[model samples]
Target chain A: MNSAAGFTSQDSATRISVGDALTPEDVSASSAVAAEDTARYALMLGDDCLILAQRLGNWISRAPELEEDIALGNIALDLLGHARFFLTYAGSAWGKSEDDLAYFRDEEDFRSCRLVEQDNGDFGKTIARQLIFSFYTHELYSRLVDSADATLAAIADKALKEVDYHQDHAAQWLLRLGGGTAESSRRVQAGLDAAWPYVEELFADVEPTERLAEQGVAVLPSALREPVLDRLHAIITEAGLNPPEAKGAFGADRSGRFSEHRGFILAEMQVLARQHPGASW
Target chain B: MEETDRNAPTDQVPEGGVVTEDPAEHSVWPLWEVFVRSSRGLSHVHAGSLHAPDAAMALRNARDLYTRRNEGTSLWVVPAADITASDPDSKGGYFESPKGKSYRHATYYKQSEGVPHL
Candidate 1:
């Protein structure tokens, strides 16, 4: 557990090693509470990570190879950890626990964007989703480190490093799959085509986030679009694949309106908690 | 080193496209040996092995396999086939020559009486 690099800590003794990120328990005990708008903003971020983690978790035993299986599982766990941090902070504002927010929320209450809820069609498609999601977070968290709220800033700074590794992982796979054999290239290209339309929904300015962005507590999602798109195009070209020209999907909002896959993902995620209330492992 | 007939077969590598049990697909990544440095000052010890397409991907696989628990400060991956080892069947010739040669050892000689730092 390496202590978070560049996170401001007034007490040097508390600092540990790399990857020793902030746990939700730390957020629970801390004095910093999320403001109303900041809570709503954090909820969306948390939900996105939560749903994607669920999607990634399905690959634990199903990835193409053993090495790849472990890689995807580790990534799923990291996303879950990020979700815990954000959800715990968000829960602070509403007198709820992280589990309460995660397990009890209905499909309509979830504020996650459509991109995360989209299906992991194949290994290539999953990698495509990972590329888009990780690159987007890399940009969002990079800017979010400077948020006016100290806790959000700290969480973002910590999550940024892990997300950067995720971006590298996805980009490496993209290069390999896009440039390998003819079949590999075709599958990965089709993957990009399947996932590209959902990209625009990620950049939409939704609810409390748009307001929080004005106060410097949350990043403006639209501001991240150009950089994420440009990098995606450059990487896609470098891998010898054409940039996807798919039109943006309709009804791209954080209101949980656009996606049909959200319910299935939620059912799987919330089942154990819902089945046996107050369950602890 | 063990000097048995079982330790002498290095020529019996399975040919490409002959992997039978994997069932799903035939493309098998090459095996890579992983070494991990536990901390800044420590030497990298043999961690484990994994299969990957290339050296760059091998490093990433090594990280996920050996260093996921923060057990390493640094990592190195080498293709398993690249590492040549002494033939275990010739261990008697390679290792037994040094046996009963006490005169070649410094402990076989007495230090100078009362010499400083002897």
Candidate 2:
């Protein structure tokens, strides 16, 4: 791969975005340590992205069209990048690495809300799941940009821009699917019906984040409920479908205990890392 | 690898493409030509083509296909069907008409007499 076109290897390597910006690497290199509560909160956010990213990654080659495959893959990578940032910062409090937090953790140890762990049923269902989570995350990160913790603020600032696009992508698909045809509308509505019950878990104001929110280091998830739901209902109506009226499912908490899909997701994700513990290319 | 019926499900189209039992579900999306500007103050150049349901989806698909590696600062996706292109068969016709017509060149006019910014 030596350069025959006159550019040096150094130029090739250095031509990547050489801007001063927050990255997972930058987070890892800093002397900043997350307080115990902050670390736990970081894990909750990180685990959400990590698990959902795996779910989205399954669509790489399976999407209906080639263009959609790349679109989903890009989003999966964006979520994975956010996961890296949060998990890396969370690891700082415990002297572990991002990989350690991501791969070595057990299902019950995870703090991610159930909304992200839902199956990607049809494309309609996937977009339905995406619409809820993206809208919720977009709202969460918008307020988190002003967090008391500098590290959390920086991470939120960086992740928000991507989350903005994620919400748009989900919304576009939602509108298209919900308005395309009778069958299309029906399936997407079914998707919303299936996903709506889990929406409550996203705003539970979980233990660590609840305390952090009081200290102004985290955005209170409960505060996001009305706005997110209002927007979701408006968009669903605009798409000509009734928003689901189902109650939030029974164990609407981030406990990971009631989640039927989390263990199955983790087994597939963790098997390779466990089988070949320090293996690398 | 041997080729088999990659799409034979009862719900899928029998032969055309990946549309489903919904007979009105268009099998193939329209193609779009994507143009990307590498940075500001630069004209967009053709990057590639992709299939999308409409103009908005075309723009997004263009973004995913062409701008993945920081290659673009802006994107433009035009419906491929809408663009009127010069005939490739015109290589020896109209395009060649201006090529060898040296009188059409401004280079022949040795710089304007007193044009300051020419």
In terms of DockQ, the best-performing candidate is 2
TM-score of each: 0.88, 0.87
Candidate 1 local lDDT, B1-118, one digit each (tens): 9567854435454554354466226678988999998778889999889999999999998989988766788999999889998998999989999999999999999888888987
Residue-wise C-alpha lDDT for candidate 2, range A1-281, written one tens digit per residue: 22332334343643644334477877887899999999999999999999999999999889999999999999999999999999999999999999999889888899888888989999999999999999999999999999999999999999999899898999999999988999889999999999988998888877877789989999898899999999999988988888999999988778887999999999999999999998886
Report how closely model 2 matches the true complex, as a DockQ value: 0.46
Report the poorest 10 consecutive residues by lDDT, candidate 2 chain B: B15-24
| Pairs of colliding residues, candidate 1 | A2-A17, A2-A18, A2-A20, A3-A17
Q: TM-score for the second chain in candidate 2?
A: 0.67
Each model's lDDT: 0.88, 0.88
Off by over 4 Å in 2: A1-20, B1-26, B100-118
Model 2 residue A215 lDDT score: 98
- Candidate 1 C-alpha lDDT tens digits along A190-218: 98898898899889988867788889889
- At residue A272, candidate 2 shows an lDDT of 95
Worst 10 residues of 2 chain A by lDDT: A1-10
DockQ (C-alpha based) per candidate is: 0.44, 0.46
